[model samples]
Target: MKIAINGFGRIGRTILRQILTTARGSGIQVLCINDIAEPEMCAYLFQYDSTFGPFPGQVALETGALVVDGRRIPLHQQANVTALDLSGADVLLDCTGIARSTDLAERGLSAGATKVLISGPSPAAEATVVYGVNTKDIKGARIVSNASCTTNAVAALVQLVDQVAGIDSGHMTTIHCYTNSQPMVDAPRGDFARSRGGAQSMVPTTTSAMHLIDVVLPHLRGRISGAAVRVPTASVSAVDLVARLNTPLAEADLMVALRAAADRSPVLGWTDQPLVSSDLRARPESLVIAAPETRIVDSRQLRIFGWYDNEWGFSARMLDVAAKMAEAD
Candidate 1:
């Protein structure tokens, strides 16, 4: 199965790297990459050993191909979807984060792909998927979304809470990693006022992930409220989730349910020990189901913490889900 990626930034390159390491790599023939950045630099980024962490072996760049674990795989570069080489590709993962579903979806089809998946939620699209909660909804999904990392973490948490104790309501405060949007030196952006003043500040930002949470957890509509805090870190983020349960259980039982639920879903995990946001930074997987301290904010209110490697984790699951959907067809 051949695959094409729309952007070569964080998520796009991560997707490329993961596919190369998969058991299906040998059968996967071509990897088509499209980005506005210098294609050579982007290609080189995948060639060298990842600074985030080492994979099993080094990946070498060979002329117009990438040697993953010593196996040669052909590469093609394009600046945009219009020029992308997707002739034999069965799937396309759009990590551009442009959120333009119609354009990317059409481009994927035009490039000869049967399915198109995106790394982030597309508000205009039909399906927004959280790996554990709604992966089964991917049937006939020519266009699908991984939902943002915040969405994934929150969705999994809510699913677990609702299943074990039943949710009366839920809310989240995502202490997110800084993104390309903010200035490193407090320079002015087009929207000068909003991001202008806070180069080093803990910027309070509106999260689309909150809206996406409702999309993923349909039962939580009108019951959940959400917000975000964009921190100075480059990667990794945590969700501070609080939920009012229909029935209250002891803290130990709650942790037990979370661990059990995480075990049932590969995307979810529960670390028995203490973990911080920095601890999860650059982890290859998206959903790390670690529940920190549980607090009762009110009579029925409970607060929990979860961590994720926002870009890597979310992109990884997006690729996994898209591949599974393709194979199912």
Candidate 2:
């Protein structure tokens, strides 16, 4: 059950740490990292340091790779996925978010991997998984995509509502954090032509999270819409939701239903008191189902709020999904 990692940035490093520390036994002997950055920088980032917080075990920096609990993982310096030697791994985790699923998945399959899972969304995935919602559908998927953080949270909300109160329709606004792709200061960048020079400012853009949520929660498929705004913050974000309910539910009943749903969904949690984005980020869970300060503008509509750690929490869930894929194979 050996595994290979394609990127070593924030999500990539977090995946590496999760795989090595978990007792689930991924048997990830060789970590073939394909990144443009220098190999030593990747090693430095993956190497565990107690200064940040507590680690499950010690991580040592060996000659040219990282060692954890006596397993020495060889880090290949190759930048091209096709050129790398992946003959030993059973699965490959594509954390690069490059959206080259067809090429990378074919490369891994050619290299003798049983399956490949992408941490971010990919158009070629057999199905997009949202853990508690559609993980059962991934029993034999060859290639899978764990939806984005915003998608995960929104999907959880939709599933809970659809199961309990019943949803007529909904919309989401994801206030996300800055990513590594964005410049620290205002400068010309890629994508939106008008967004070329405003990395430091709030950039209103569209998010496919709502569109992709249907891949997991088919009941709400095409029934919801979403938009995104990139804030200056680095890690935490919140999802503001507005929904048309099938039946009017009292605030107390809705809160109880949400908490019950959270208890069922390990990644989804509930918080009663008022909380900021930073407070929910510290919960150490993939998704938190905070009972929103709900209000009914009319007889059949309700609104909710949810928060998540765009990188750490959601990325951790990606690692969990990848691990499950390895175990099933």
Candidate 3:
């Protein structure tokens, strides 16, 4: 699968790193990159990422190209989608966060992409997929949205519990790390709370995951609702989910059932280690259940906590989805 990244921010850079390391020789390769920054800045940022440490391999800048591991991927500084040369790319991964319309997204196809997989939620997407949970529902859509990071984390767990224990209703609060969307210090942005500082406070906000989950898990349409709290952190996030199950059970029993399901799941992970969010900074799993933190109250009330490196996990899944789209194409 040939990939073209449209943004070179946290998500975009990490996607390239995953392709070079964990996804190496897996038939997925980055063919080109498009960003507003110059090629020199792109190479510098990719080489020394403060969150994930160094790139591990060499990253050098050439004329209009970024060299990684001795391979030069063509780099384009095109702010307009029509100017991007995705000549041989099978999938154009839109990490720009601005491709919110079908007209903007479809322009990639005209530029040469066989399919366009958006990194964030898009009203224009023919399908909003959560990869491991609802990849089977893709059905060969030409334009697909991978949905949000929180959506991917929560949806996987929700499906697992609903299938294993049966969920009557649930609520999720993603203790997510602040993203580029928020400001570093107080500023006059559109939203009131978001105007206050991203790293300066624990700002409460809404998440689109609640709505996207319904698209991925249709039966649980009205069964689940979600919100998010942006904490002061660079990477790694947690999901604090509470559910009322149809069948009541002990805490131990629920753990056993969920673990078994995660064992069979593609993106879900299981970790019993006593660790904090910093420990999971670079974890590739979509959601790793912190076993000991899970508890049951009144036999029916369930609380579960799962961790994820939001940037890395989402990037990994996007690549996986892009590959699936390529196969169907």
Candidate 4:
């Protein structure tokens, strides 16, 4: 599979790293990378990532291209998707985050990509897959989304509970880590709340993940609501999800159901050990249920704590989706 990545940000770079390291024998090759950053600078950033540490192999700039483990991958310092030469690419992963419109996303197809996968939620997406939740729906989808990290973290639990007891309604509060979109220092921006420095405070922000959940699980439409707060952290995000189920279960049975779901789904992980946010870094699964922290209120209400490596986990899922798309072709 020939792949092209549009953005070299958090998720994009991680996807490239995964394809180069863990996905080596999967027949996936990164044909080209298109980003606004200069080729040399992109090499530097890819070589040294603070959150995930250094690249496994040496990354050097050779003849205006990035050479990773003797493999040369050209980097194009272009923002216009239509100008990219992606004819050899079978899949284009648009981690740019700005390609939220169909017109913008279709540029990849126009540029010669067979399939386009957006890293984040996009309204134009034919399907928004949440890995274990609804990946089967992406069998023949050309332009799909992997959904947001938060949605991936919650979708499995939602589906598992809905199947076991049926979810009547739910609300999620995601304690998320700061992202590149936020300002590092207090600076003026359109939104007052977001204008505050990301590293300086816990800022409440609106999340589009709930809308994405509705797309993946239409039965939860109009029944689920959610909010997010970006805390001062470098990595790892947690979700506090509370749901009202149609059926009630004892604590022991509830645990059994959750464990069974995790066992059936490779994207979901269940752990009873007390874990901190740092312990979840580089975890490949979409969601890790903190079993010890899960609580049940009045039997009908359930509160679950889930953790995820937002960048790594989500990027891993993106690659999984890409592989599925490639196989379908």
Candidate 5:
């Protein structure tokens, strides 16, 4: 499987590193990378990630090609998706986040790519997949979107709870870490609150996790609401989820269900040990349930807290989705 990366930001680089290290035997190859950044800058960023530490393998640029651990991949400085040569790519991972329309997404297909996977939520996606929750529904879809980190975190727990006790209604509050979208210093922008310095304050913002969740779990449409606040942090975020259940469940029973789900699903993780947000860095699972923070009230309402390394975990799931799509082909 020849993969082409459309963006070289945090998620794009993470996915490249992940493929170089783990997907070697799966026949997955990163044939080319497309980004607006200069080749040297992208190579530099790939070699040194502040959040994930230095790259496990060396990276070098040779004749306008990127050599990662001895594999030379072409680097293209192109921003227009339709203008690129994608004849050899089996999958094009659009980590750009800017391609939100069906017309934009079709550019990859029109350019001769077999499939295109968007790294984040998009209205143009044929199907929005959450690895553990709804990947079974992605049967050879040409365009797929791996919702968002928050959606992945919330959907895993919600699906587990719904399977065990049945959810009546729910709400999720994601205490998220700052992203590249936020400004480092106060600046003029359309959204006044987000334009403020990101590292200096906690800013409440809207999240599309709820709507994307409905895309994956259509049965839960209009049953969930969500909000997010970006805090001053480089990595790790928490999701505070509350759900009302139709079937009453004991706390112990809920724990048992979560443990079973964790064992069965690759995307769900359960931890009883006391852990802070920093403890979850580099974790590949979509969400790690903080068992210590699990609580139930009157055997009907449930509260669960989950921690996720948004960039790493979400990118990992994107690779998983890409691999699954490859298999389907």
Candidate 6:
């Protein structure tokens, strides 16, 4: 499948690397890139990544293209999506995170792409698929959303737990990594707390994952609520969840079921060791169940912890969604 990337930020660059490396068989071929960044700058950023280390493949820049592994991908620094020509693209990934509405995202289709995929939450999307949780909802929908990174982890974890042992209600807190949205040093921003230094201190903030959990797993609507804490970390985040289960389960039995679930899932993982955030760097699974931290109180109350490389895992799932979109056609 030939794919075009709209934004050449963290997610966009990672997606390209994943296709050539980890997600090699996903059938994704880079058709073109439409970003506001200069071709040379894009090549440089793609070459040296802070979280994933330097890209393994050769990265170079030509007249108007970025070359990776000897493949010359046309790079266009177009601020207007409608102005760029996106012909022959099986899917155009709108990773800009700015196209939140169907009207805004469908401009890819208007520009001649077959399908449009928003990398973040788009309640206006024809279908919002949290790949591992509800990719069944992705039935030939032209405009689809893979939701957000936190949403993917939360939905995958919640769905697994809910399927194994029934969950009545839960409150989740994601110990998330700070993004570019946050400031490097104390600076002016709308949200006072978020305006504080991102890598300096932990910041408590709201997450769209809370509301999006309801969108993907509609049955779990009103059952789960969550927030985020931006910790001082470069990569990898964890989900801290406390829930009351309909079927009261012991930790041992729950582990057995969850282990079995992870065994059968491609996008879910289980780890028994006492692993930290960096341990999960470059992990492809949306969430890895941390066995050592599982706790149960009153038998009915359940607590679970899941680790995820938010950037890598979310980009991996986008490939999954793109593949599904191509198959459906």
Best by lDDT: 6
Cα-lDDT of candidate 6: 0.89
For residue 74, what is the lDDT in candidate 4?
A: 86
Global Cα lDDT for candidate 1: 0.72
List the pairs of residues colliding in candidate 6. Answer: none
The positional error of residue 258 in candidate 3, measured at the CA in angstroms, is: 0.9
Number of backbone clashes in candidate 3? 0
lDDT of 2: 0.72
* TM-score between candidate 6 and the true structure: 0.97
Q: What is the TM-score (0 to 1) of candidate 1?
A: 0.88
Query: Model 2 Cα displacement at 109 (Å)?
Result: 1.7
lDDT of 5 by residue, 1-329 (tens): 78899999999998987877764326787878988999999999999999989998878998778998888999988878777889888889999988799998888898778899999988898888999889887796999999999999989878888888899999999999998889988877678889988998999998989888888899989998999999999999989999999998889987887778777878888899999889999888899998999999999999999899899899999988888887775
**Runs of candidate 3 exceeding 4 Å displacement:** none
lDDT of each: 0.72, 0.72, 0.89, 0.88, 0.88, 0.89
TM values, all candidates? 0.88, 0.87, 0.97, 0.96, 0.96, 0.97
lDDT of 3 at 249: 91
1-329, model 2: which lDDT tens digit per residue? 56788778877776666566654335555455566677667666666432224446666656666666677777665656767777777678777788455876566666666778788788878778987777787788878888887887788778877787888898889888777666666666666632433346787877879768877777677899888888877668888888999978777777677677778876787777788876754344666766656566665687777788777677677766776787774
What lDDT does candidate 4 reach at residue 180?
77
Give the lowest summed-lDDT range of ten residues in model 3: 22-31
How do the residues 1-329 of candidate 3 rate in per-residue lDDT, one tens digit apiece? Answer: 88788999888998888888884327777888999987888899999998999899988888888999898888999888778777788889999888898888897898988899999999999899998898976777989999999999999999988888899999999998988889999988888988889998999999999989888898889989888999999889999999999999988888888899999999999889898999988787889999989999998999999999899889888888888898884
Let me know the TM-score candidate 4 reaches against the reference structure. 0.96
lDDT of residue 1 for candidate 6 = 91
Candidate 5 residue pairs in backbone clash: none
